[model samples]
Target: MMSKSNKMLDVQAMDTSSNTVLSVRHLKTYFYPDDGSVRKAVDDVSFDVQRGRICCLIGESGSGKSATAMSIINLVDRPGKVTGGNVLFGGRDLLTLDTKQLRTVRGASIGMIFQEPMHSLDPVFTIGEQIVETILAHEDVPRVEAAERAVTWLKRVELPNPEAIMTAYPHELSGGMLQRAMIAIALCCGPKLLIADEPTTALDVTVQAQILRLLVRLKDEIGLSILLITHDLGVVAETADDVLVMYDGHIVERGPVEAVFDRPQHPYTKALLLTRPIIGQKLRRLPTLHEVMREVDDGEIAQPKDWSTLATTVQTDGDKGEAHSTDANGNDHDSTPILTVRHLSKYFERVHGLKGEGNVKKAVDDVSFDVHRGETVGLVGESGSGKTTTGQTVLRLHSKTAGEVLFDGIDVFALNNRKLAKLRTRMQYVFQDPYSALNPRLKIGFAIGEALLHHKLATKRDVMDKVVETLELCGMDSSCVNRYPHEFSGGQRQRIVIARAMALQPEFVVADEPVSALDVSIQAEIINLFSELQHRKNVSFLFISHDLSVVEHICSSILVMHHGRITERGTVDDVFNHPKDDYTKSLLDSIPASNPKYRKIGR
Candidate 1:
C-alpha cells in the first residue's frame, strides 16, 4: 500500500484536467535576511484552483497567504527566493519560466489585484490613461480603440459617469471608485486566473458588497478562476467555493466552504471564526486568540478558557462604572456632556473645468452632536460622507468653515494659538493608518513619550517610565520601546499608536478607523483594550469607522452621516435593530453574513 503522504499527492495529481486551471505543488519561499537566519514565508504549500471557481486562502496577517500568491507568479521580491516546488499552468511550470517569458503570462493570462490601489496605480496618470495602457499592453489595439474599451470596462464594473471617471485621476475618486477601477484594469485583459489580495479590506460595507457581487458576476459570465487571499472569514464564507486555511506558512486545513465553516477541524480555524464580531450577538467581552489557544513547547495547542469565569471576573472588578449606565433610549440622562458641536460646517474651494471658477464643497454641513463623558459615540458613513472630517473638526485639526465647538463648556473656536496649543494635551486623535501615523525613523519609545515630554507631562528622567507604563496598558512591554515602527507587525504598530494617544491621558480621543485594517483576532484585542481604557480612565471617544458591526459592539450610541449631514442618531440597540433611515438600513444589510448557509445570493 502507498504511504499516506504519497496517497495525498496521488489524489492531487489526479485532479489535473482542463477543469483545473492552475496547480501549486509543494511550493517553498524563504526569505534570507542579514541576520543569517532564514524565514520560511511559504513552505510546502500545495493547492489547485478549478476553472470558474473561487478558492479563498484565509488566515491572519503574516500567515504566508500573500507569499504563496506572489510565489505562484514568480513575483517574490529580492531577499526572498522561491527555493523549491512547481507552479503548473497551461502545460508550463511558471517557476522555471524566464523573466521575459513570465512577463507574457502575467498580464495576458493571469491578472492580480493588489491590496492598496493608490500604491498599485500610477499617481501622475489619469484613471483612463492607466486602464487604456493596460489594455494596449496585452492587445494589438489602437490608442483610440483602447480608450473606448477602457470606458466600457469601467461601465461594466458599475462605475457611474464613466466619462468623468476616465478624466479623473486616482486621487479624485473615492475609495470605492478606486477599487472598482482596479478591478476594471485587472479584468480588462480577460485573464484565465485572477488573484485578489484583500481587495475589500479597506472599503465600507456597501462598497464591499458591490465589489463582491461584481467578482461573482465576472466569475459566472467569463468562467474566471479566482485565488482570493484575505483575513476576513465573513468574506470567505460568502464568496468562496473552497477554503484553504493557512497558519505559520503551512496549509493546515482544506475543504469546501460549507464544510470548513460548518465543522472546522483546525483549532486556528475555529479560533478565527469565533473572534469575529457577530452582528446580532452582543457579548460582554469579545473572545481573543489567546483565550482560545495557548502556546506549547513544540508548537501551539487549542485550550479554550472558560468564558463564564472571565465574564464573572470582569463584572466583579466593577470597571464598567457609568459607561454601562443607560436608560431605555441608550442615553445617560444624568451625566453631563463633555463635548458639544453646534451648527458645525467645513467647506473647501475648488476650481473646476479649467475655468478657474470657484466652487464650494461642503465636507461637513451643519453637523451638530454631543459626546458624553465616559461614552463612545460612533460616527459612521461611506467614504466622502464626512465622518473623518467631523472627527478632525471636533479636535480642531481643521479650522471650521462655520459654527462652534464647545469642550468642557469652553468655546474651542474662540481659543487663541497659545491656548489651543495648551488644550491639545487634553484631546488626542488616533489616525486610521498606524504606519503613516508613526514616524518610521523614530523609536517607538520616543514616539510615545515625545508628547509627554513636549507637554511637560514628564521629565527626561521619567519619560521612559511613563512610556513603558502606557505601552503595558496597550498590551505591549518595555522591549518595544527600543524598536522602530518598521520592526513591528501591523497589529503591534497599531498598539503603539494607541499607546501614544493614551500616554497623555486625554479626556477625549478621536479614533478614525482604528481597527479597520486589522485581522479579526487583533481587532478583538483592540476593541477589548478600548473598553478597558474607558473603564479605567473614563475617557470619551468619537470612534469613526465604516464598519457597522464593530461600531455596534463598542459604542453606546451612533450618528449616521450622508453627503456631509447627519441623517440618523440613536442608541446602539435602537439604531441597529430598528434603523429608521434608508441609508442606515442599507449599511446594515451590506454586512457579510458570518455563516455560509445564510449568505445572500445574486445582486
Candidate 2:
C-alpha cells in the first residue's frame, strides 16, 4: 500500500521533435533515511526542454522540482540516489557519464546558476578568479586570456563596472549584482543549456524583472535553452514557453505556458494559480492544496471565483480597518490613529576608507507615517530604501536621531530602557529572516509560549493551551510543538515565527518581510491570516515588503519610500492605479502579473 501510494502520477506526452536540448524519461530519485523509510523525491518525472526555449518546473517546497534538475546534472548527494532515469542531453546519455566525463561536459555543455549566490560564491576568492577557474576548467586557455573572457562575459550580462567587480569579493556586492556575477560565471564557458534554480528569488521586483529580461535576451540572442526551476508562477508566466507542474515527486501536468495557465488540467495546478494574489483584487481565504486534492473525484473543475467579490464582504464589515476601526461594542468604526510617527529620522556614522572622519548616512530621513486602529499600513521599497530601518526605529530597536513616535497618544521615544522593555509586549516585531530570527536551541512550543510566560499574559496552567491555539491559528499542527526550529521547512518556520508574535497578542505588529520566503499559496494563507487576526484582535500592522501584490492585498493604505524618505502615501487603489511619484510608478511597473493572457506573454 505504501508503494502504491508512492506511485508516480501520469504525465502527458510532450509535443516536441528531435531538437530537444535536455530530455529526462522515467526519472526516479529516492532517498534512504535512517529510519528505514524511502522518500521518493523525484518519481517518474519526464519532460523535454526544447532548444532556445525556457521550461519552468514550479511547485511548493519539497515537491521534487529541484530534485529533477539535480538528477539531470547527476548532482544528487549523500543517501539520495537516482535509481532509474535517462538524461538525454545533446543526443548523449548524461547518466552514463562518469565523473571525469561529467566534469568536462558540465561547464562547457551545461551551465548552472544556483539559487543562493552567497552560498555558491567563494568569499575567500575574488569573482574574477572564480570565473576564470570555471572557464579554464572547460577550455585550454591561458590565465590572462581566461581572465579577459571572464570580464567580457560580465559585461555581456550588463554589469556597470566589470573590471572593478572582478577584483571585489562576493560580500562587497549587492544581492542583484552578485546574481549577475553568478550568471556571468555560468555563461562564461558559453554553454548551450543553462539551468537556473530560483535565480531571482531573493531580488526585489525591479531587479527580478531585469534578471528575467536578461535571461530572455540571452535565450534569444545566444540560442540558449534554459531549464528554469522556480515556484513563482508570475515569473513562469512572463518567462516560460512551456510549463511543468510538479507535486509530491511527480509531474502532474505539462503544456504550453498559456494553455497550462489559462486552463490548468490538474487540480494542483489550478490550486497554485488561484493562490496567486491579484494586484487589485482581495481574498477572504486562499485556496489550499487540500481543497484542490479533495475535489479531484469531481468530473469537471470550474474556474476560480473572483476574490474581489468575496473580499468585499470581508472588507464591508468584517475586515474593515480603514482610517478607523469598529468600537468594542461591535457598532460603528472610529477614525482615531493607533500609532503615529512624525518626522522620524535615523542616521549612521560611516567612515571613509583609510579616513577616520564620519560620513553621515541617513537611513530613515524624516519618514512620517501612521497606523490606524486595526489597520494595515504597508511600507514598501527596494532594498536599502529604509523600509526595515523605519519599522525598527519605530519599535525603538535603534536610537532615533530625530522625530516623535506616538503610540495611542503616548510618546514612545521618551521611554527609558526599562519602561521600553516592559512596553515591548504591546508592540512586537517579526523579523525578516525567520531562519535567523528564531532561537535554534528552543523547542517550537517553548519558543511561542516564551513571550506569554515572560509577560505573564497567561498563567502556567493555561500557557500550553494558548500556545497550541496560536499554533493552530497559524496553520501549524499541534504535533509540531515538540519540534525544533531546524526540523521545519522555510514556510513552516515562518509560520512558527508568526505564531510566536501572535502569542503576545500585541495591539500592534511590525512584520518585516514576513512572507517573502514563502510560495504563492503559503504567502496567501499567511496574509489572509494576518487580516483575520487584525479583525478579531483589533491589532494594527506595519507590513514591510518589496512584494507589491501582497501589499495591495492586505494593506488598506501604502507608504512609498525612496532614498530614506516617504515619497507618496495613499490608498491601495489610488497609489496603484494613479501614482504621483516617479519611484512609485516604477515600482508598480516592475510588478509581474500572473495573468497568462497578458500582452507580453512569454516575452
Candidate 3:
C-alpha cells in the first residue's frame, strides 16, 4: 500500500514535474432551504485525482458522492450551493474561478459523463452532431475536423460503425450505445479529468461490465484521471485505485482501494459489505427496510465478525471474483417443489410493416423450472431475454401459449374464470418500479388493504387493522397509512407494494426485479424481508433480476435466460460454479467484483 508521505510526494511530483489533473479539498456543498437550515449535500469531503488514477466514491443513494462530483464540474443546479471547498486543477483553485472561467474549464480542461445518458443527450440532435458541437465549442476547429474527431472518439469508445452511430439520434441507439456515445462526446476534447457518475446503473450486467472495461482501457490509453461516483462496490473494486466510502454526506472512510475493501473499519462500510450479494452464499432472508432503518437509527453495524474476514478476502483487481458462502446456521431445511412449470412456451403474433407476418415470437421458449416451498428461484437474464415474460406467464398474467403451470399439483391454465380469480389470490406480483405499479391517488392503507378486501380475507371493520398489521410486517409504520406513494422514497414505496402483494397471504409471488431500482443497503433489507416472509408464510418466489450477485445469495435455484430460452438452470451452486452454456458463462463474467485483489480475468 502507498504510504501518506509517498502519496503526498507523488502528488507534488505530478503538479510540479508532470500533471496533477484535479485536487479537491474540504469540499462542503449544501442545499439551502427557504427557511434557515441547510441540507449538507457534500459535507467536508476531501479527495484528489492524480493523472491517470481512478478514484471511486462508493455509497448509498443519499450519500452525497454524486453531489461532490457535480460541484467539481460547477454543475450543481439551483438550491444547491458550493458553500465551502477548494477545487484545484493544475495547481489553480477552480472554486475561486468565475462563471466564464468555469465554462472554459468545463469540457476543455475537464469532462463529465452524466448518470443517465438517455436524458443527457438530446433526442432531436444526431449523436455525431452533438459530439461535433462539443468539440467545436471548446476547440477552434472547422465542421469537417469536428466531424472527423467525433467519429474517431466514437470508435475510441469501441462503438461499432462509428460513422453510422454518429448520424443516428440518441433514441435510435440502444441504452449501451447511447452511454458509449455520451462517453465518446466527453472524450472528444481529451480533458485531463473525467467525472463518471453511475455510468452503468441502468444497463444490463453484461453491458455494465463491457462499459467498465472500456472506461478502464480508455483511462490507461489517454492517461486521464477519473472521479467515479457510484453505489456499486463491484465497479469500484475493479477500477478504483483508491476509494472514499461516503455515508450521509460524509466521507466515513478513505484509503487505498485494497486497504479500504480488504479491511473496512467503519460500521457503515461493514454493513454495506454484508448487504451485497455474492456467489455461493445462501441467504435465509434479506433485511427489511424497517429492520435496516432501525439499525441505522440505533447506529448498529454488521452482525457477525466472520463477515469482516470475507470482506477482506474478496478479490477486487478482477471483473469476476470468487465468492465464499458463510452459513451462520448449520440447520438444513426441507426443500420440496411448490410451483412447477413444465415446458412452458409463450408466443405473440407479430405485425411487421404492411403485412401481418405469421411470426410467432416465442417469449419463454420450452422453459421448465420449479420453486421449492419457502425457497426463492432466481431468474437471471438481460432485457428482452424473456426473464420478465417467464415470471408473468408463470403467474398467468399473460396466457401461456403452450405447456403447464402447476401450483401445488393443480394446473393454473386449466382453471375457469372464477377458479382463476380464486387461484390469482394464491399468487402475487411485485413489480420493478413501485411508483408506477402503485396507484398515486390511493392512500397506503387502501392500497395494501385492497388485496385483503378483494380476496375476502377480512371484513370492512377489520380491514384497517389488517392493513396496519401488513404494513408493520413489511417494515413500515401505521403512520404511513394516509401517505401517498410519491411521498415515500423508492425503497419505501417498494415495501408498500410488497405489503400489498403479501397481504392476502399468497402461496407464491413473482418478484420481478423488486430491488433493482433500490440502493445497496435498501436492497439488503428487502432481501432479508423476503427471506423472513418466505419462512413465516411458507411462500415461494420466482425472483427475476439482471443482478446475478443478488440472485446468488437469495435464490436456491437459478435460471439463465438468453434470447427467449433457458440457457442454464440448476441449483445456485451448480450453475455459478460450473456453468455449461457459453451464455451463462458470459453472464457470470459480467458480474462486477467487489474485491479488487483478484485480477480481472474472464471466468
Winning candidate number (lDDT): 1
lDDT of each: 0.85, 0.83, 0.79
lDDT of 1: 0.85
True-vs-predicted CA distance for residue 450, candidate 3, Å? 2.1
| Structural similarity to truth (TM-score) of each candidate | 0.90, 0.92, 0.88
The TM-score obtained by model 2 is 0.92
Best by TM-score: 2
Clashing pairs in 1: none
Candidate 2: clashing residue pairs, number: 0
Writing each residue's lDDT as its tens digit, candidate 3 over 196-249 gives 999989999889888988888988887878889888888887889878788777
lDDT of residue 325 for candidate 1: 22
How many pairs of residues collide in model 1? 0
Winner on lDDT (1 vs 2): 1
Model 3 RMSD in Å is 6.2
Can you give the lDDT of residue 457 in candidate 3? 92
Error of 1 at 72 (Å): 1.1
User: In model 3, which runs have C-alpha deviations exceeding 4 angstroms?
Assistant: 1-19, 34-37, 283-305, 308-337, 349-361, 414-416, 601-603
Worst 10 residues of 3 by lDDT: 1-10
lDDT of 1 by residue, 314-427 (tens): 321334422332321345432888899999999989887868898898999999999988888999999889999999999899999999999999899899999998899889
Superposed model 2: Cα runs more than 4 Å off: 1-16, 295-300, 304-333, 352-358, 599-603
